[model samples]
Target: MLKQAGANAWFHKGDLRRAQAWYAEALAGMRAHPEFGMEMWKVYKDLGDVFRRKGDNRRAEEMYEAAIQSAYDYYKPFKNRELAKLNCQLGTYALESGDLDRALAFFQEAMIQVFPEFNNADPAANPAPAEVYTESWIMDACAGKGRTLHARYLRTGGEADLTNAARCFDLAIEGVRQLKQSLGNDAAKIYLGDFSHAFFEEAIAVNFLLWEKRKDPVFIEKIFELMEGSKSSTLQNALQLNRAVIFAGVDKDLLRREEFLRVSMAEYQKRVQEERMKGETKDTSQILVYRKKIGDLEREYDQLLQKIGEEDPRFKSAMREVAPVALSDFRHQILGKTDRVLEFFMGKNNLYILSFDRQHADVRALPLASGVYNELFEWLARFQKPEAMNADYADFLQTGHLLFKQLFGDLAFPSDRPLKLLVIPDGIAAILPFEALNLTPPGAPPVFLIERAELRMAYSASVLTQQENWPVKTKEWVHFAPEFRTGVRGLSPLLYSARETEGVYGMTTFSGRSATLPAFLEWAPRCAWIHLSTHARSGGNGVAPHVEFYDSTLYLPGIYALRLSAEMVILSTCESGLGTIEKGEGVMSLARGFSYAGAKSLISSLWEVNEFSTAGIFSGFYQYLKKGKTRAEALRLAKLDYLHSPDRPAFEKTPWYWAGFMLIGVDGPVRHQSPVRAGFYGLCLVLAGVAWVIWRRRRSAGHSSLRRA
Candidate 1:
């Protein structure tokens, strides 16, 4: 126990060397204390964690195997929660090492060990957890099996892989929901931590894979439902500040106390900051005191919220009220002339695209993995950089031509009408600049795909569906262009932001201001549209994206605090739309963040932009919008305007200048209905009502005559 405990302490503190030494000592101790019972098993499991942290996977495998043997030795049946936990750990190891079949077997065995009666009876009959629902080991096991199956599917294109993957994820989700229900209000007392987040992400992802493979809009609808499930599980209000509030039936005093703790936490943070800034004080005692105060307040606040939820069911009902949009409703609302949509759904082994017009929809698969897509994306990302524009153009053009042919060549293009493409990029494809793809022959003058067709982009087809009926109120626009004082360097000033704002101000009723956090939070939600012309700092490898303002930054985690219903949000900053790409979670970009915050349309840059050229494109986009063009069409016309402008330079004509921005979300004519159509609908309804009354009266008169005879 001593050695195992020491190893866990060191591992959590990130001291890998000390952790390894303690784990080694624990292994020796386990041999000496052969009769140590379940404690011996824990030592083996802890050792495995230590080895995994050290990247010695072979040793980790041996440790996991020892843990399983210890579990068998202790329990007669060897079908306990401890055994399940050990098996799940092994499954995780195998999955990480790329042994898909082995991982799936281990996960399946673990699931059976935890819920042996799962196959015999309905899931509702076994609502209670084998150990405790809060442990989440079973959830992890199911998610692991689903992920491994999906991986194998990518390799073999097996329909069974998808079927089993979907089943495993569904079981896990149902189990969670059932457990929550069985617990009732007591469910609020349990916090499963980040495992629940990962579970839902995997669940949504597996269904997305099914949707991509099957091309059934029903699968997409399932995705929407799963997303709603994810949101419903979140106890804090997304629209308001990240705080838990008492529902109608709950005691208001609970909320009042919770609010007080939040205020106290904020005060402690402010005091800590003030103490740190006082350089004269080499004594940081006050900062430590304030930090402890903040921690205490946070714990108290959490407890208060939990109590409120346990006291009333209305809290949960209020949280679950916001559901995801339906697919059928979205399909029926698809109204546009040249609007063609291409939705990319990336699986572990392949990429899928569903292309559709107002009248037709079809699905196609791209036989490319994340590795291949990354290679092509890296090339495109490089080509879009300002410094790379002057380098050898042949390789860039060749790569462009290759990608263009691969992505669009198989799809049937409309022969009669002009094509306005709305590209919904997925996974690595989020970083791809689709408009830059070359459609010209090798060695011919560069002719970009944007020139051949109108192109816009989207976060997801479901997001577009959600925005189908969003009314564009055409209110005043809010523009932001803040100057940097620190943490940003080695870049020329965006003088064009001022020029761009000036042009926009003249065209419409607009309010332009410095991009400060306070000002942004105040103005963003009130306007119909927002355009930020500041800087953005995007993180790689599964980190949240953020936009840097004058005094502070807005991160993905905090974006939900904003209650925005803006028609559009334009992020004119560098890579503002790029985010951490996770296999099952999709891209966590600023564009997605804005969409989640209730923006109907978004314009984001996949890469950095040329300030002057971006200014011109912005002007043209607004001009087209004012003239009643669809959001997608307006962006296309803007890019074309930039490409063909008489005052533009040769470099400006390249896709690098005009293709950085992409429109994502809704795509259709802005002003489709008028007063005449409204009046006609009213008249038709009146006539139908009159005809119904006449038919009912005639039927009644016939019955009366029959009775008289």
Candidate 2:
């Protein structure tokens, strides 16, 4: 038999493509040799890596799954590390496709089969103490999944999404720390990758979270530890210059510009004064020169001369050297903080929130709830000045039709028609006076804007007592269309004295999910940008289940975690985002489940989403999008307005109502199609009419000729 040593040598030599190909060939040749079960499984893993590199997710998942289920198992005592890795991928797809329950099930099932080692703050806390896992493998899963989850959290804004991410980071740090303590003696090399990447990623993730949470710079300081040994790259430069920006927040108490100037100048002055001390006495001319230098130094220390924001040249200089790791880190930084929660008011970046209605007089934290409006403007202002991400910001802004186009492209700002944002009840617009506000669509005018409003039912119809304040007494809410379209409609009536009006389209469906109503079965349609399912959810369980459909689905008939389906799904019913259901079963709630689902995002209700607030939040969200604001921008504005209601300020200010709605599709394109394709047959009718007329003329001429003969 061929020696394992030779095969491993090739793999270690960085000949991945060659090694992978060799492994493939060897496995194919050894297929008849059933005794080489474990070897065959290794080859399959190699193939999975190769396929993954080639951008074939399907093929890679297939190979990995096969290895875990069969080939590796067929061998003597297969490794749990490899199996766990494959299951993670499988769970990703299910999560993305709106089956959050399924996704969790897959992950839990995979973890059970794999006997994974816990590499957290306590390496000794492995659930599977009987069969230990290597640190290398744990790190492998942690690093890869943590990075992916961080991105996911920003897009979706689901607390559950970040839960495991925190776990992974802790495990990574602990695993590494433990390994450092037990190097060579213990089998911890397997987790080296996780150890290497976790600290930095976690620091960035936490910083971004804090910025979103408190909008303070102190949280950013927490990341300095990661730059302890790293060089000045994009991430490093971002971190380096961040000190100035962070200082601005606390600057009220701590002279920010002065501190920077003093520190930088102090170091220079100290060096100069030291040199002067060493040198011998010079001529009067030298004394004059030193006096002139003193004048320059004094001028440099003046705070007035230094630019207040991005105009500071020191920032530019500090960041000129773009570090690759730093750049990647910065990217993560931006990705982590962005939110779709404020999608209710797609206001101008410079536009301030103003409720002329007087009812919102109770508003106080209006500024805080305004989402990213202030932040985006700050960044926009900074972009005008020197910064490495100036180009990146420029590109993003330019991507928009109006402002962005003015800076970058020929595209115009999005039409007045709402941006087609699926507003969730989780936003501030929900708290608005729905009746007072004009929830009507756009009228034909200078701004060709039309807002399509759709409400997401996060909770199921079964248990809605949680929202006792919301009395569903009005038929107007249930009636999506007018009552006139009650029965079957065969024809349209004439505008003058007509018997009936336009009826509801048949394509639209309004039916209960099922009789049993499984507690959770996330079913987000790929075509819909927003999904609304109503169901009760709780977070009191050891096993994390992000989402579920109904009560029955928990553990009885279906037993699934609520999964997500679209960019945003409004869990209007209950605490859908709560981390309920047992771990391994999946997210008992639907929000987290859908984040894993393909929809790319979700918006969930809290303890009990106020029906009035929920309605207003969604109405304004769609209306804002109609005005062409990004999801994050709109949600932010709406939240700001809700925060204006002074009664709820001190305790409830975290734009959770506004920011809770996440953008899952941030990484992917909105899967959609134009009307041209949906109505292809309508165009074909013209061709058919033309053909029929031509045939009639030919037949008439032929008959006339025969009659004449």
Candidate 3:
């Protein structure tokens, strides 16, 4: 194990020579022991990777073949899956080497290994078999086959080949959807989502190529469906399941048991993390125990969900494969006449953008600029270090304008009205600060994208449409602003959070020591609006992102277990909107955590935020909310106010201060019935009741007089 670990460490550091040496040693040692035979395949695979990195294609193929043989000989139970994966790796290698025939054969063999039924099918007749298989490895095989066919089509200009490639992609995506639905927990589903993101991108690209070649609207529609199907699918599934459980009338006891299991799993996960943080002295046995407990709880929870589904057919149907909203339905139901959606899917060769309004939809592909992904990371880093931007304002402006043009230059916006644009970003574009993009030329006075449009973001058009009527349990707001004056848990004091709390009104406030995790759990679900003004850490080193309370921190899993009905959640902390990017799943941030816990909308920071600036911006944000502005408009107005504030220093007015804070999810008004309005309604009801009583008495008296006559 140590040898293998050493090899892995060197491999990640790009020390191919050192990694190869360690892997060779590990392979020799494993070969010596029959007990370690099952693990030999991994050492073989590692050696293959090392050789591949060194560009020793012959040696790499030999190592890969040896790994497959070792898995077949020693790993009997899961040998099929292992074989499929190995075959797919070889297929990729063949494709990269431009051996189209060899690549296609390897990929088909991979698919057959997983689903033996495919062994008899003719590869040329139908690349995607009708038989459904749930294993994720099949997705990889289908993707490999599709890519191979696509390459062949490009070379030979064969229409049949292109059509077969599209079919292969269809099977790949269906496999993804099936695997996601099969998962019992969100964490597993989210992790799985990262693996298949490239498949979706490739699928979309292939479909787009078909659309261009054949001029068929069906191909265009397929691209949109693929985009919507892959984006934020876990979140969409969670939303659907919640709705199904509620509407299916699952028993309260069963629901309670499910929640209990989830909480238990989260607690054990946290315990494992805590134990692992003990470093070299950590108790391995205890960590193992915690893991076992978590696994057991997950299994139990899955069974509970299954039982619920069995009891209510509605739940079972709802939990079936998720279908993305059609493009026409999305435009009609989700987009206003003035609204447009700019959905992006970044492929290996091109960045495809789908622009749609209420009445029109268009798709365009642009060859990706070299190092554009690196440029995005650099831009985000600059936001974290504002002084860098201040030093080269002109360069910053020019670069930002260039990026804006690259991303949005071809789209035509309506001239008569301001646009309400919803941007659905994929891949590295997830963390992009769209509002900061300068729309004007470098020499011209900066006109940011935010100035031309009221901007909001969503995971997908389907998610946006579903959130339109998400239930809000209460009209009340709750605020938690903990002052970490003692540096508990190594956190600095939030000097302005207290001030921020003071400036806000009509909220159930928990400040200082009173703002604990328990308090948050108690009140967060009951309130429609929640504001947590404290410190937070972005996820790293295997730890999930967490928000610090006075007594404890709530990690992502803990947040997921919560059942919140908040219309909006405000995370007034650093990098609350940033986390380890999980390709198709977007950022695994605290913002997403809250979204999983049922928050319809969120206001979170993209970078380390200035406490004072955050306080001022949110004060105005709530004020705008009080005035019945949409959440997007309110946030926009607040940022604009902060940017134009005369009292703020000129340096503070840069995009760094205001642009990092963004609103994601449903951007609608916070509906609160004021005390004055409530009193007026009560008075009107009372007056109407009195008039009814009087009319009833008069009618009775008139009837008595008539009888006497």
Candidate 4:
């Protein structure tokens, strides 16, 4: 027990070498004691984890297999979650190693352990019971089998293999939905959704392949459904829940109960977190107690929410599982006549671009060139180092043009005017600055892609279409600019932010000592637009990404707790748009946190931005917003204005200064004035005009009569 504890301590501290040695010693000690036989599987699993983390894939697989063997040999009933987990691990190993038959066998065994009556011969014919679908192991097993079958289809070009793969993926995706529904908290749901991203990717890939082979619209429809169902789903759910509480007219008592339970759960979670952070000296018993309390609270919360949903049909609809909008409906209802959407899905070796408009839907597959990913990373690195970009301008320009050709050259666009393009990026494509790509001929003067298209991004097509109808706040703008001159928490003072905030008209400003996290939280929800000019740190060194305010830091999890109704959030901070990339879920950035908090649109920076340039650009951005320009157009024009400014040095005109910021989600005007309000204002203006005209006519008549006399 002591040896195992030592192993865990080392593992938690990220000393994998020492952890591996300790685990080995522990395993050897356990093998000598017959009473410890049943517990041997745990040590082996730990060893597997250690090996996996150390990048010893071969050793990791062997350890995982040994864990399964130990479980079967000593455990009374081998059909258990632990055994299922070991088998799934082995299955993933085999799949990655290209041993499809072995991978499928291991996955089948995993399913059998979970269901006990699971038939590998006909998995689709006898699906796991709905209640059992909440076991994430079953979902992983199904995804593994589906991926193995897809691999087989790729090798043999068999339609049967493809069809079976699609079916398995469908079952796996359904399991994902059930699992998410079973969770009581958004954090847990987001974790599960992020973990299950690969399943969605495989599902989309297989269905897209099936569509290519069959040429059926149903397969295409399924592809769109999967895309919408997977991408940024947690953000969508949070928005929906807010809508349910606010607009669905849910009972106040029920809402209060739900809030209490959530808060209680959060307290318990915090306790557990604090205990775990004690490292080698942590109190296991206290941690377990806190976990149990959290679990109890979660169950109670789930029950209360279920009751509320049952009592209110609108709540049920709002909180219900995500359903895919039909392709026809998406095209006709969601897309405008001039709008075009390019949704990219990056598979292991192929990139699929689904392009659609109100009149057309087409999918194109591009086989990736060798080392293309490395090239992309290298290209992005140049943006951070302006010296490198300036040093090799020719190389940079050539590479940029080549990337443009690879990504967009094949697409046909209308030549009448610039395209209103909505981009849905996946994988590494999320960080890509599409606007920075050179679109001109190699020898011709540089013309950027942004010049040819007014571009904005969406998490998914469904998210884009499902616009939340939060009540408009009376206050138009709220700005925060925190001075970090003390250098607390490694943040530097933003010299230009205070001036920048002052430049904006009709905004409630919080600066220096007053720009605290608590103050922002209290007033942010009451405003239609939020602008935060502060320092932000991206996630690293076991710390979550956060924005540093005057008083304290607000982490990503803290951001999730906020209930906001702002139409736009401008994060004029460094790397506010950067975070840990969670496959299908997009970047877990501060910008995404605002989205989860119900902000309709966001303008955030991808990298550490030039504070001076950011201030100038955003000043123009607000002015354009006041002119009622769309968010995407306003951002584009703001960057353009910066580029055209003769006062700026030529060296600063590079994309490194201006291309870091992106506009995400809805691209509508900053404040959408209600039609009724607009009509009333119009009536008042007309009445005032008539009164003036009548007065002018009476004066002219009086003057004419006097002249006649």
Candidate with maximal TM-score? 3
Best model number under lDDT = 3
lDDT of 1 at 283: 47
TM-score winner between candidates 2 and 3: 3
Per residue, candidate 1 scores C-alpha lDDT tens digits across 1-709 of 6877888899899998998888778778777877666677777787787788788888888887888888888985646877778778788888888988788778877777777564322211222343325335667667777778878888898878877777777667665655554332212413432235556656566666777667777675566455434432322123222212412445767756765675566456545544544567634887777767766766776677567667866765554433444545545554343366565665545565556665665555566653457657556766556568547567778777878777786554456744667676666777788878887779898777776677766554444554654544446567777644333443345666655545343223222235677888777766676878777756553234677666665666456445566777888888877776644334557776677666777888877777778878887876676566777778888888888888977765777888788877666553433222333456778899999999999999999999999
Best to worst by TM-score, what's the order? 3, 4, 1, 2
lDDT of each: 0.65, 0.38, 0.81, 0.78
lDDT of 3 by residue, 1-709 (tens): 7899999999999999899999989888887877888788888888988888888988988898888788888755443777788789888888998999989988887887787556643568443455766887888888899999999999999988888898988888888878877777777887777778888888887888888888777886888898887788888877777666555567889888977887898898788777777778999999888888888888888889889888878778877765578987777776752378889887766778888776566688877656566566766667877898898888788888878887786666568855788888887787788999888786898988777778888878777776766766577778898888888778888877866545344567898889999988888877888888999888788677988999997888888787777778899998888888776777888988888778888888888888888888888887776677788888888888998889988899889888888878887665566322343456778899999999999999999999999
What is the Cα-based TM-score of model 2? 0.28
Off by over 4 Å in 4: 1-132, 250-317, 347-349, 365-369, 468-475, 483-495, 498-505, 674-709
TM-score of each: 0.68, 0.28, 0.82, 0.77
Q: How accurate locally is residue 168 in candidate 1, as Cα lDDT from 0 to 100?
A: 73
User: Model 2, which residues run further than 4 Å from truth?
Assistant: 1-509, 512-530, 541-551, 554-565, 580-590, 637-709
